[model samples]
Target: MDIHFYKISISGIVQGVGFRPFVYNLAYKHNCIGEVYNDADGVLIKLGCKDIEVFLDELQALAPPLAKITKITQETIEPFERSDFVIRQSHDANSSTTILSPDIAMCDACKKELFDPTSKRYKYPFINCTHCGVRYSIIKNLPYDRINTAMGVFMMCDACKKEYEDPTSRMFHAQPIGCNDCGVKTFLHVNTTTIQKDTLYHTAELLKEGKLGAIKAVGGFHLVCDATDENTVQKLRQNKHRPTKPLAILVKDFAMAKKYGVFSEKEKEVLLSKEAPIVLVKKNRSDLASAIAPGIDKVGIMVASNPLHLLLFEYIDTPLVATSANLSGEPIITTKEDIEQKLPFVDFILDYNREIINAIDDSVVQVVDEKLCILRLARGYAPLHLKLPKKIDEKVLALGANQKASVAIAFEDNLILSPYIADLDTIESIEHFQSMIANFKRFYNFDFDVVLHDSHPAYESTKIAQTFDTKKVAITHHKAHLLSVMTEPSECVSFVFDGTGLGEDGELWGGEVFVAKERKYHFKPLVLLGGEKAIKECYRVALSKLFEVYPLDEVMELELDVVKRYKSKIPLLYHLFQSKKNLKTSSVGRLFDMVASIVGVLHEQTYEGEAGLRTEALVGTLTREKRFEFTIQEGVIDIAFDFFASDFVERFYATLCSIVITLAKQEEKKVLFSGGVWQNKTLLEFVISELQKENIPYTFNTIVPINDSGISVGQIMEYING
Candidate 1:
């Protein structure tokens, strides 16, 4: 009896990831005689087995682990007299364009060739085949062939063509295959001329000569320099207009990272993961320069991934502050024209002519208990959407904000959390977000049914949602925060704190206490603002409160100048707290801001969380750990602020000092230190000292982040149950 054969098409992140090879092996093992090919939509599989049931079971059940089989469709046809299974050249189904995958990190074989001087790709910055090299940034269309990519101009030579045609070879069907004969070249621009075309070695010399240059990294443009040189770093900071925000330092490898930051097993793994993300690591007292990460005790660091970075390290002995080549709070520009126009301050530009289809900023992460703490997921990690734990029936798309942004895609019940971070805080960022989402929809052939947006109504993200012609669900900013956390239902006293998030009441909210069970929550906003000026001025607010109680004018009968005369920092507080533009805020972050400002720890903040960070650093050094007394009466936990104001700041000049003294004399108390404010080292030191004197035990976040990033995960859990 004659049997019919079946042809199948599968799509969604199926290519480059060993999918075709896996299917070839599967078809061969199953005794099927049909061919598999790559098309616009995923992989195409064919089956012509005599025993249909066995062939179907084996093919369907034993798919590759990484292959995300989104949809599968098959058509039955007359069987061909084929003897063996093979990977035929890809056939064009004339399908829609596909999303470009990221450049995977160098595999073991590539890493081996990198050090071998005899290898063709030795010290080659753009060494890649299918396994690694630029993907999403280089591709403009689907079926992911070289003709559809930026590398199309560089044709394959005899050696590469041989490997590519040989089915038994690793490079078989590898689209990005390139050789020295036809590969990307680098040129150094000294002034207006593109000089130093011969080698990457001379580029290092120019950098050493105090020349500010732009380096074309594998995924994007990077501003490189010797981190040990104080002047070089300071100059970049001034030029980049990023003086206060700490720059991430890139080391040669994991071994070199040991010199500056403390890394556990989890941190090391994340540093070397395929994504090759930058992780925040705690600095040892004697490690690298204090100025590297200025206000905070922790520094962001990453090991070099691109081969060019490795080559640069060979010429220079010290680590480089390998930050993105762009202005502060701006998107990293990739095109040459943009480089010249935007980075006029740069001394030279090392550039190549290639089109970047998509822009992915660097991924930034932190380590917790040797595991990755994702702060910003970009580059090697973007477009890799996070799978939702729960399935929802509504077709929903969330337009997250530009800062700490994330878009949630819901289909039926399955949702996708598209990896993203805060945009560069500009009108262009909002436009980019809208454009990317439109692209995401086109790429997946899916449209938003009911859209969910943050309640920050004035935000660009919210505005984008309104533009969409779909049902809208405006999730409160804080609710999104709570829902993002606790993906599962659980009863817990949750403390959500951060820089700022829009709350249900149309005010910037961050510090919050909640009794949560699934999506059901009763939230109480902490740190009330006295008026418009108290927005971020935490210290000024406290001073205002103290004045109300102490009656400053009566305390010392003198001119209004007398209150301003002590130069006690109270005058500035008055001006700040009473200022019209200061704005009102009931956030815990602002509360810490006030404390840090008042305690003489920080007068002005250069970055969003700098004041809190400096204060925490100081606390870590010498903490008396004085546990403040409070009472939980009638559903409300009330603490007396009278001591902090009337007695503490008025009659006594040093309340923090007194708190330290009190804690130092105690013993055996269990001290709990948390909130984003605890990220301050100095406050932690004080808390630690007091706890130690009293023999108090303490635990900092290991399973959970001590920052607002984790607050959303908690929020997720709280809402998931509902």
Candidate 2:
């Protein structure tokens, strides 16, 4: 019989996801004789088979669930003598091109074993197999193996070692394979006392008593408490200094999740996915404390994704308020010491001995217009890798905008993005950003040829870019937002609207329409009377808008709460508006703030997107829709409208939709939507419905975020197009 020898190279997320064992079994099934192993680039196979094409077809068709095969190539080679198909040790090279798998949720098999009394791993907090376990967060270096991960320090017991070596066992070659006999131990710390025995039981008891505890999770730490306890939830808010921002809840399973929130089919699928991100859904139960989301009708919900979390749920019945353990605008805390020192309100600490090399927060997503929209990309959805349309000659790094900071690195047709780093507003957040950059460099053994940053000169990311010892290029912020959603270099009309970004003309431009790469139109500029203070106190923007069309006495005569409350400061605010010395902005996000204040939804914002969220909530409460007049002339759009109408919020949204439709009609091209403002579901749905009715094509971000967290990816896209 004739034999064929072929060398196969496969790349993409093929490591630490049970790819090697799958390949080993596939080789035997195909009657092939050779070996499979991992290398720097990806999986490599040397096969001697009768029909290589048939084997290749089955390989792609029956690959593991978590494996993502991007590229596969085969080359004929000299036939070699091989007795049997086997798995070999990983081969490390100078540099790596393989994509790292994001951390995956616990598999059904592991969960089953965790609850089985007969199983050795029953009630074990760190049980994992090759099918599902920690990946990115525990990994320290490439060519993924036990020695290169946080699990290397733990020696496997006799039973675990036997299972690790057995090809038929699910734990075969699992990097994080461990059992209670020889793995990390959990401990509960309460008021200078350490409780080592029955820690999970004690932790659950404390949480049931409405005690706030910091629990170590797969990526970082979570400040956990009973979600139904209003007093505990309020205490968490005061202690964390996160006043009115919504907190996410962790449920035991889909049944428990359904009790608190109404999930669509698509939302349910994403919630149960391996990524296991927090999904925003309609609040269904009033039993949950009102303080959980206060004023917002939607609640963020996620299922327990890891073994430790699942085990905790076995003892606790109530949903747990699982907010990241960190200061406001800071990275998630990863160390036990840090959690104990920083979060003084934590009544106890549920911790383990395992080290967390990378600290990632939980990713957030929501279903918009029957499609998935990413809000915060981290944990199970990061260390994201995208294949470039074409290879680039130089290695590049993109430092994203300041608010929702993230970094991206592009090299050799591969673009890798870091997990969502918190806003670079504090010293700790800046340090976290720098550490993530350093981690990426070390992971890929990378040296950048150039770095890209926002045009905003004073942005912390821009300042850090100047410190980098490499060539730097500044791209306008709005343009970067536009390019992030564009798949190819084509002429299209893009509407980039957000709260703030530096324009090419050195003004704060957020409400902008661009044809191709050139800005074609913008909203009429509105003066921010107190600069940054206007953002925190949204009523100032409302007053400024009112002063734009009305005289001081006329504005004062209007019976508005803003005017009644700030009656004394109105004259000075009007003077600042007339002087125009304050920063000028064309921001639709500020428009939301203005409308929200006028409707008495909120006069001040405690969170980043509070005004927008409250305004969006009002869209559902409107009894009727009315027309609000607007004008487009001289490359500017005027949004001055009557603020006294009962349905002003509804009319304002309708007018914005009309503006987009009008622009699309004029441009006669596909429309691309981006920026943080698109996260407002009501407005985006309105525009989408109108565009579809008019038979106008439109596109938006699905893979990455539409917010500033995706700015780094957009910056790279801009550079590539240029």
| Shift of residue 124 alpha carbon in model 2, Å | 1.4
Q: In candidate 1, how many Å is residue 487 off?
A: 1.5
Q: How far is candidate 2 from the true structure (C-alpha RMSD, Å)?
A: 1.5
lDDT of 2 by residue, 1-722 (tens): 56799999999999999989888888888789999999988899999999888899988999988888988999999989897998898898887788989999989899899989998898999888877889999999988889999999999999999988888888988989888889889989999999999898899999888899899998999999999999999999998999999999999999999999999899999999989999999899899989999898899999998988888887999999999999878889999899878998799999899999999999999988889899999988898898888899899999999998999999878888889998999999999999988987887786889999999999999999999898999989999999888455366889999999999999999999998889999999877879989988999999999998799999898898888888899998998888868888999889888988898889999988898899777774422135587789988999768888887788888888888889999999898889999998888888898889899998888778999988999899899879
Q: Tell me each candidate's RMSD, in Å, in order.
A: 6.5, 1.5
lDDT value, candidate 1, whole model: 0.60
Q: How many clashes show up per model?
A: 63, 0
Predicted candidate 1 versus true structure: per-residue lDDT over 127-225, tens digit per residue: 665466567677655666777778778778888888777656666666777655666777777776766455577877876776667888765688877
Where does model 1 exceed 4 Å of error?
1-12, 29-31, 39-41, 50-81, 88-100, 285-290, 390-394, 412-414, 419-424, 490-493, 517-550, 553-584, 621-625, 633-722
Q: Rate the local accuracy (lDDT) of all candidates.
A: 0.60, 0.90
